[model samples]
Target: MDIPSGDTARKRISESTIHRLSRYFRTLSLLEKENFETVSSKELAKREKLTPAQVRKDLSFFGSFGTRGLGYPVAELKAKVSRILGIDRIWRVALVGVGNIGSAMVSYKEFIKQGFHIVKLFDNDQRKIGSNHKGIIVSDIKNLRTELQDDRIEMVIVAVPATVAQYIVDDIVKAEVKAILNFAPINLKVPSGVHVRNENMVMELEYLSFAMVNHHSPKGGGKA
Candidate 1:
């Protein structure tokens, strides 16, 4: 099967579709581990809390899978989704800031397994410089530009405080890192052609609280 081509075709495939593909990939992996050879869309959808039609529509964007009467081969579907998501090749990642979130990201083992390799850790704190965490040496943030140029780092993770997150992101942009995952609570401004995904746990928690309140509200989850 072929990946969706052309900017127009790519644009038609929504980010939510891509996210669901990852979930499907994970489900296929678990099914594989359980010795399942094939999976029907209905069965897979049940497992993922999605409707069968929704699962089928998402898979249609990539290509047809599963036989008319049979179903998808677990291993084959996983490989296809992985390739479609561009995770087939390993990605070099650089992380700036060694605060709690940053340190935990460095120690996360799943990233490497998923093909994201954190090659260097950078922090401005003097005490943290040269310190080792999770087999990665922490270097001073001043060396970021040089380190990025010397290495093939394509993605940067910024986990510093909100006050300094934009400055760190500017450095990352200057270094030509195309993608960034920022955990800082504030939004960052970047130039065109660069992508930034903000991961704010506080925002998520607040949203969760809103949902919980809505669920118990008088109108059966009506808007507040």
Candidate 2:
């Protein structure tokens, strides 16, 4: 992957671009597991349901990884994308709210495999404060700032209710966390330097339902 020189003026890449890169990485990893060595842009695009031009354009931003005709080595491309996404190194993550969603995240193996470790769990509830799951002792939310600073946790996942999500995020920011992945179904305002990504499962499911309904509409396959 091409690393831009200090003298090169770089423009901010879009989130969609990064999402596509992640897809490419995942697809490449699968292919690598199947013992594939190299793949062409056309083949990669076909696997991703993208145009060859689109795949090429997305990769071009990071520098050329593919040969003129032979294509990209699967292992090399996967590592490059992982590096670009900042997942090549282990990142200590703090989880706020050990409820259903938060607990699920705690047991999620993908995050750990992808180099994100949930080192701390927090909640304001007294009942949950001392609870333990997979060796993670739930701590009081009041200790978040000190624990984050002490542990040097740079990222946090906010799986709290919408009402208190922003408050938790504020505490995360005060602890100098750099990134957040929020599962609460609400918008949050954060400092300029902090990045927050909201994941709304309900919104996604609603959109999927709309698409399914449209697919079965009268003009398509549904009964009049």
Candidate 3:
């Protein structure tokens, strides 16, 4: 594959762009399921509430995907997007906590079905460490490094307590993991080049409540 120029590479693709690409792929999959053959960028953008120019630019980053007159083929575009995002390959994931949220995630069938396989689960609690969840045994946190290396886990899910978030991240960095999805409600300081995605449930719920309260307020005129 021809690499993009430095200028193109330096043109940082925002998180929103990546997310939209995934969304586009999902939409295309649905269209394919409905027997739709091709889709114009303008049509896709309208359905997704995005600008056609934005759609074109995002897809252009990969390569010329559409002809001047015709639009992108649904199946081809879906395959290209999946390949670009590295979703075509299975990604090994390791979970660092076996608490309620972590256990639920471990038992969630969606992750495994979506190409992210949880090869190892870890926890500090002795009783829980040796137990099994969804056919995967919870291992001791002390063995994180060894298990990570053995399982070739590239991505990690940090569900440890907030107090130990930083400590766990540090250990994860030392384990040479590339990407992390953090559920702990703490700002973690990771070394450069490592990706950390924080999923803060409390913050999301608070934001939702704020939106609801403001929407119903007299000052806001109950817009709905």
Candidate 4:
């Protein structure tokens, strides 16, 4: 099947470009909310620690998001970026493993503020499976397929332990979920067309600690 122009652009664009686009969108949204009318590529780049040429090139992937002289209109660019990122669509997400992190996410205002809604929470623990948290009742893992079918869940958040990460992911795939945000420290393999994003919190913390140590090193040579 032929991919749509938007999808093609997304596929062709580098991952770094997509990340920069997300940053630009967030910055532009803040500027728009502050009632800023126009912003130059240079200013935006300076704010985001990116090059003007890179910013322009990234925006160009979507067919000239900015004017030649006026840069990019804040509101228009915000809307365009939102559309490009598919933020306009409300994605129904099913969260597996209603433990500490998962339960916190269920009550997190940011998820609700954004379009991603956790419609179902699943856990194998009998005590938790029937409990309610933040208005999202916990359901048994066995009902994953049925709930996914009934709710048309498009995304899955796997917050299970590393030991059961693969098994839970397999169940999620069996339920036909296409996208997953995995919090476990395991590398999960999925079939083609399935997207998996790993959230390695320990790695992130280690990186942060490494950066801090290097930043405050006496000789400024603790590079890695």
Against the true structure, what is each candidate's TM-score? Answer: 0.90, 0.91, 0.88, 0.89
Off by over 4 Å in 3: 1-10, 216-224
lDDT of 4 by residue, 56-116 (tens): 9888877777778788889998889889888877999989998888888888887766688
Q: Write the per-residue lDDT of candidate 1 for residues 78-131, one digit (tens) a residue.
A: 898899989999999989999989988998989998999999899999999999
Q: What overall lDDT goes with each candidate model?
A: 0.87, 0.88, 0.86, 0.84
Candidate structures ordered by lDDT, highest first: 2, 1, 3, 4
Off by over 4 Å in 1: 1-11, 216-224
* lDDT (Cα) of model 1: 0.87
TM-score of 1: 0.90
Tens-place lDDT per residue, model 2, 1-224, is 34466988566787878998888988988999999999888999888777899889999987898888699998999998898888889999989999999999999999998889999999999999989978999999998889999999989999999999888888888999989999999889998989989888888678668868877353323210
Candidate with best lDDT: 2
Question: Per-prediction RMSD in angstroms?
Answer: 3.9, 4.6, 4.2, 3.8
In model 2, how large is the Cα lDDT of residue 211?
Answer: 69
lDDT of 4: 0.84
| Model 3: per-residue Cα lDDT at residue 36 | 80
For candidate 3, the per-residue lDDT at 54 reads 87
Candidate 4 regions exceeding 4 Å error are 1-11, 212-224
